[model samples]
Every structure is written in C-alpha cells, then in structure tokens.
Target: MPAQTGLRPLNMKHGWPALALLPLAALSSIFNWNPAIILVLNITSIIFLSQAITASSVELAAHLGELQGALLSATLGNTVELTAGIVALVHGQIPFAQSVMVGSILSDILLVFGCCLVTASYNKDVLGFNNALAKTLSSLMMITAVTMLLPTALYASFPIAEINKKVLLFSRGTSLVLLLLYGGYLYFYLGTHNYLFISDNAETDSDEDDEPSSPLANRAKLALSVTRLIAAVVATIFCTEIVIENTSDMADTLGVTEVFIAIFFLPIASNSTEGVHVIAASRTGDTDSAIRVIIDSLLQIGLFVIPFLVVIGWCVAEPMTLFFDSFQTVAMFLAILVVNHLLRDGQYAYIHGAMLLALYCSLVVVMYAR
Candidate 1:
C-alpha cells in the first residue's frame, strides 16, 4: 500500500526477503500441516517485522513539524494488535483476548523497547533522556504492566508449591519496587546534574520527510491512497491470521512455551511492518520518532493484544488463565528498570539499545535453555 512501485533501495534488508517468502510460507501453512512448516511461516513473519523497523528508519529525517506524521505511520504500523483487538472486541471476542493485549503491552515495553534501546546503544551514543518526564511516564507504564497481579496476590492466602506464597508475593511486589529504585537512580543521575543518559548527537544530512520511495505527485493523487490503505490493512490481517494459526499449532505440537511463542514470535510476525520503519528512522537519525514508534508498539500491545487474548480465553475459561504470567511480569520489571535509568537525556545511542537488547536476549536464551 505504501508505494511498492518506485521502491527505495530497501536498506532494511531482513524483511524484503521475508515478505517475498510469505506467499510460499502461507501456502505451506495451509497445505503442509506440519508444525515445522508452521514454525517457518511464523519465523518469516519475524523477518518481515524486523524489516518494518528498518523501513521506518528514513522517517526520522523529516522536519520537526513533519515528525508527527512520521510518528503516526510508524507507531500505527507497529500496533496491529491494537487494531485487531478493537476489531475482535467489536466482533464480540473479549473474554480471553484481553489478557493477550496486556501481554502485548508487556512484551513491547520490555522486549521491543528493550531491543530498540539495546540496538540503538550498539549503533551509537544516545543523545540524552528527559529526566523528569520520562520517569513519570515510566512509572505509569510500570503500574499498568503489573496491575493484573491483583488476583494472584489477594487469592494466595496459603503457601503453595516451590514458589510459595511469600515468594510469589515478593516476586510481584519487588518487581514494582525495583522500578522505583531504577527511577530513583535515573533521577539522581540525570536530575541531580551528574550524568546524561543519551547521546547529544543525531544523524546528519537527513531531510526529515523526504520519503525515499515516493508514491505521490500532488494533492490529486490522494484518491489513489485509499485503495492502497485498504489493501494494506487486508493484507496485514490475512498475514496475521496465518502467523497466529501456524504458530499456535507449532507451539502445540512442539511443546515449546506458550509465552515464548507469543513474546518472541507473535510480535515479530505482527510487527513485520516495523522493519520498514526502523531503518527509515535510523537513517534519518530521528531517534525520538523511532522511540515513539516503540512506545506506540507497547501501547498497542497493552490496549489491543491483552484484550483480544482475554476474550478468547474467556470463551474457554475453565482450564487456563489468559492473564499475565511470572516470566512476563519479571521481564516487564527488568525493562522498566533499564529504560527508567536510560532515557533521561531524550537521546539514544548504541549502548542504550545494546543494554535493552541484552536483557531481552537473556530472557530468550533462558527460555530456550529450559
């Protein structure tokens, strides 16, 4: 939809290949029925999502005023679950899908943002973070991330299992508490006038909104855009279904962790468009816009993913709970802590991204190791 004709060089390379492979993957998903085939389809989605991030990299070069539009496209693109969640709710699937939405939010904040921060860090120095504002918003996100635990905490009157009542309570309680601690460090480091969290430098020689791949010639061309938008939305939806359907079956057949599937694979697939966004943002050096996309991704996960999943689980609620799990909860805490300390100067770089990536990588490694 967004101009596939006069395409740019496609600097964000991972996704183009993935996108190209999709037709075959989709076909395999339908006919093969083999879990491995499904897993391949799911993984291809991840590659495409990674490409979305790369594709959006160019938007960062736009003028300050145009930044808002860039944010809209990138953030909205990263937030398919939010759209899907709304669609599902309207269609009356709200019981279990709701929790998946929560999980999505959690995954975005911890996993996506974490990866962004880490990758940005490795790429270059973060300019600096907004000390006071970032801390406040981080706190808000942290609260929302952990609030689902009310059920587990209040209902656990007796000590249970290897984890126990006290352990579980501490696990949840301390997770939130660490955010405060992390925030405190960030405040002192940035607010106390001792340190700056991000790099002051941004990418240079970048024209902010100069869409490398132009699809418009004048206002008269606007009419053509509508058809493209619809097609894009429809394509995304069909692709998403293929992604989830195959991934779900694969998880069942392979006995891999469900959270692992959702956290690592689902977002990658759903956010395939992000690969396009990231490269554009990175090329333009508009870290702010890129970060905003990251934020939108997190919000969509929260507002869209958890809600939709909650509805599905609600429809079949006797066996399992579709709410937040321990691994995800811990990951959220760790993410908040990292970003709370990292975003003070309102700039980003290689180190910040690296740190965030490290956290997520550790989580994934451990999950696979188990």
Candidate 2:
C-alpha cells in the first residue's frame, strides 16, 4: 500500500458549540419565544443538526469504501432537503417544492461545486478528478433535462389544463421511468461499474497494528454514532419545518416572492451541510471526494428526489408534474453546459471556480428579476 496523505482538519471548533442551540430552539417552540429569537435558534439548530449528521456519517464512512461513503454522505445530507420538500408539498406549496428541486440541482452543480473549487485553489494551482465519471454524471443530467422539460412542453403543445388527467398520467409515467433509471444507476455504479468512480491513486492501509481504538471503544463509538444519527434526524425534521415556516414569514415580511425564497434561501439552508463537506474536501486536497460530493448530490436530486417528489405529491393529494417553467428548464440546460465545459478538461482552477460562482449569481439575479 502506498503511504496515505492525511486529510486536512475540518476546522469544526465553532460548529460543535452550536449544538447547544438545539434545546433552545425546542424551548422557543414550546414557550412562544420571541419570533426573531426562535428563528435564529431554529437556524442555528439546523446548522448544528446538519453538521452532526455530516460528522457522524464521515465516521461511519471510515468503515465503508469511498463509493459507499460518498453515497451515504449524500443520502443522509439530502434528507433534510427531501423532508422539507415533502412537507411543503403536503401543504400544497407545489411551486415552492418544485422551485426547491430546481434550486438544489443548480446549487449543487454551481454554488457548491464552485465554492469548493475556490477553497481547493488555496492549496493548489489546479485540481483534477476522474473525468470519465464526471462525463457520465453530466450525461445523466442532460437526460434529466429532457425528462423535466417534457411535461412543460406537452402543456404548451396541447393547451390542456394543468390539472388535467393527461398531465397527471404523463407525470406519473415519466416519474416511474425516472425511478427505474435511478434504480438502474444504483446497480450500475455500485455493482458493475464501481471501478469507474474509484481513483487509482487511492491508498490501502489496513495493518492491524495501525488500529488505534480498542474494540470496546469502537463499539461505543458506533453506538454513539447511531444514536446521534437518529437524534439529529428527529431534530432536523422539527427544525426544517420551523425553517420552512419562518422563512416564508421572513419572505413575506421582506416582500420577496415565496418562489424567490424557495429558490435561493431554502436551498442554502438545506444544503449547507453538504456544502461544508465539499469545501472541506477541497481544502484537504481531496478533489475526488469534493467532486463526488457535488456530483452525487446532483444525481440524487435528479434521479431520485424529483421522481420521489412526484410520487409524494400524488400521495399527498396534490399531484405534481415534472413540469418546470421554460426559464427554469433553460437555466438547467445552461448549468449542465457550464459544468460539462468545466469538467471536460479534467482540471479545475481558481478562474473556473470564479466563473461558476459568477454564473450562479447571475442566475440568481435573473430569477429575482423575474
């Protein structure tokens, strides 16, 4: 086994103490605490819960290989966003849910990826990853673009009412196909083609002597990790609901559209956990992990979350089609294009990161102007 380089420290000093805010948030909810204070507590609680999940999952991932580790991290990290979207859908906030899905995709690809790239730039002039894997993920996103754009295109073509059976059936059918695709993707990536995602430079160091923790300690850590995972999830569910409600109130107070809030603010709050990990990976010069974080999140949203949302909407008696506005569809396509351009070279630089951030900001401005 090649000598392994240690990853950079996570700089988690400030994050740990934020866990104190969780009880305060719950108390505020119970006691009718000041709305502003409650909001702050809730936000802090969410941040703490997310980081808690991330921290535990990373520990958990130490036992799993890179592929499984990244998948686990992405899945757990996305839970908050998924829960929030489902809650919003059940409340008949369909547009908000849809906007969040769109925003998540954009945020993962542009905002998260760009920021991680910049953090990486501080350590190296250029970072590279497995281009073949990136190309595969990019191709998947392009397919997703077509699938999402179909309902809107059909709506425009037929002049059917939005609530018509045709739209519903079309959405249901498309969602099923997407769900199948997601299943197939899992089998392919985790089963047949797993090697594509695993880097050649990876080091394997499994000497028995190198094991630092005792068996009892290891078991205790595992137990604690599982306990924290459940607690964080429960806490996150409550905090996410509070976040959604308070964010809506905040938006109304600020006179911004709920769509705007859903697109920009909600995604940032929900995605902050994964964003932190991505940046940390970049800072540690683990470009593979950073790319995996961004790309895996995007894949989960496109292949899994959107299809799941369609089904959840139907279950909640508020059916959601795969329809996105033309503008949003265009933005998605543009995002894919930009991502392809960046990843095609198999190298990343500060300038590339800057361009991505600039593009994401421009998209935000356009959405706001709309």
Candidate 3:
C-alpha cells in the first residue's frame, strides 16, 4: 500500500497539482466565477483529478497482481470519462457523448501514444517493444473499428424512415456483441495470456530496506490506498459534472463547435490519468508497458466504454447509437491506421511521434473548422 510511505518527505519533483487546484476549481464553480476562469479551473481540475486517480491506481496495483491491477487501473482510470459520457447522454447531448467516444479512441492512439513515444525517444534514438504484444492489440483495435463502422454503414444503407428507431435497435444489438467481445478480451488477457503483459525486469528497483516490515504498517498502507482511491473518484465525479455542464457555454464562448471540445479537450482531460502513467513508464524506459497502457486504454474505450454508454442510454430513455458521422468514422479509421504503421516495427522514434502529433493536430483543426 502507498500509505507505508505516506510520511516520506515530499519531493518537489512531482507534487500533486490536482490536489491543490481541486479546491479552487470547486469554489469557482460554486461561486459562479467568470466563465473563462471557471473554464480554466475546470480544465486544470480534471487534469489534477486524473493525476490523483493515477496515483491511487498505482497503489491499488501494488496490492493486486500486475495483470489484474493493470486492468483494474485502466477501467477505473476510464471511469471519469465513462461517467461524464453518461451524464452527457442522459442530458440529451448525444453528439457530445458520441464525440467523447470517438475522441477517446483518437486521443489514446494518437495523442497519448505519441507523447509516450516522444518521451522514450528523448533518451535513445529508437526504443523497441514486444512486437507480438503490439500486433495483437493492433489487430483487436482494427477489428473494433470494423465493428463500429458496421452500424453506421447499415444505417446509411437502409431507408431513412423511422431512422432513429432503426438506429436504436442496431445500436442495442451491436452493444451486446461489443460487450461480449470486451468480456472475452478480459478473460483472455487477464486469465490466459496474463504472462504476456508482465515484464521479467521491474521498471524501478527499490531496496527492500526501504519498506517497513511491520504488518501494521502494511495494513495502514492498504487503508490509505483505499481512502485516496475513494477520494479521488469522488472528487473526479464532482469536477467532471461541472465541466460537462459548462462545456457548451465554454465552447460557444471560445467560438468552436462542441465536437471540437469533445474531440480534443475532453479526451485529453479524461484520459489524463493514462497519459500520466504511460509517459512515466516511457521515461523509465518501460516502453513495453507504455505501449501496452496506450493500447489497452484504446481497447477499453472502443469495446467497453462505447457499449456501456449505449446500454446506459437505453436504460436512461436516451437511446444512443453507434452510427457515428462520416467524419468520426474516417478519423477513427485513420488513427488506427497510423497506430498500426507506427507500432508494426516494434520501434519508437521522435520523428514518428512528431508525425502522430501532427496528424492529431490536423484533425483538431479540421474539427474546429467544422
């Protein structure tokens, strides 16, 4: 548990920014501060919340075994985005919710992965990861893209009468299939092929002497971990609600489409936890773990979060559909294509990272223009 080191002297190197900003953010929202100020606070708050979430996830991972821990962390890490999407859905922000789903996929593959690769490239000209792992994840993501495309294609091909009703049924059926696929993936990765994700060499070497041997100390650590996890989640929910509520006004103020907000800002905010985790991994030369984190988050977004949102919408009287706009479908497919090309050789370079970033920026510009 992280509590064992609770009293350890604070390192100025990596202080918790979220812990500091959260109070101001909360107060700003409650006090009806300036919209620009509130917007900045909200953005900063989410970033900090994401950092806290990542911290708790690391502690939780220490308690659970690696594979289970990683999976749990990834799922928990995504909870903020999932929760926000649901809120948007129930509020009749279907386009917003859909944009979040697509944005998460794009950001995780292009933005987060690019950042990690850039970080890794800083130390060495080129870094290598396990090809088998990369290939397997890429294949799964590509299949996911195909599944997503199916519903939209079906909707387009059919007659337009009762279009919403048709889409609702198609989405529900598709959601079930996606949910099953996600379950199978969890079983495969966590139960059968868990060994593949685990690294023989630990990323960081810690002296045994650094850890307190007392059982009481261990228990305290566990309790602290649980507390932090709970607090981070609670705080995240509050801040996310504020952000979601204010998002439209903010977008209008900034003279951009809500899709621009969802595609670029929201994903970056929601996926901040994974972004932090992956970049740290890359910095420590844990390229394999970094890549895996990026891929797994993408998988979670496509398979679990999207389907979960659809089902949640159905229950909440807001029937969400998988029938994304043409732009979204093309963006997702292109993002996957870029990821496949970059990861196929099991190598990472700054140039490739820059290219990925460029592509993401281009998409953002196009979205803003729309």
For each candidate in turn, the TM-score is 0.59, 0.85, 0.88
- Cα lDDT computed for each candidate against the true fold: 0.48, 0.73, 0.76
lDDT of 3 by residue, 171-222 (tens): 8998899889987887777678866766543422334325656888778887
Best by lDDT: 3
Count clashing pairs, candidate 1. 101
Candidate numbers sorted by TM-score from highest down = 3, 2, 1
Task: Give the Cα error of residue 157 in candidate 2, in Å.
Answer: 2.4
Error of 3 at 9 (Å): 17
Cα lDDT tens digits, model 1, 1-370, are: 1111112325544344555666776777668668776677645654554444334433321222233433344344544465444444444443323434544554555555655554444545435545554664565455545654544554465445533444434444444454355345334433563322222323222333234544455333334333333444455556555655455467777777554665556555555455344445545454444554555455334433343344443454421232345555566656665665565445666665656657667877876665
Residue 41: error of model 3 in Å?
0.7
Error of 2 at 82 (Å): 1.2
lDDT of 3 at 13: 24
Candidate order by decreasing lDDT? 3, 2, 1
Q: Cα deviation in Å at residue 278, candidate 2?
A: 2.0
lDDT of 3: 0.76
Q: List the residue pairs that clash in candidate 3.
A: 18-48
Residue 55 lDDT (model 2): 70
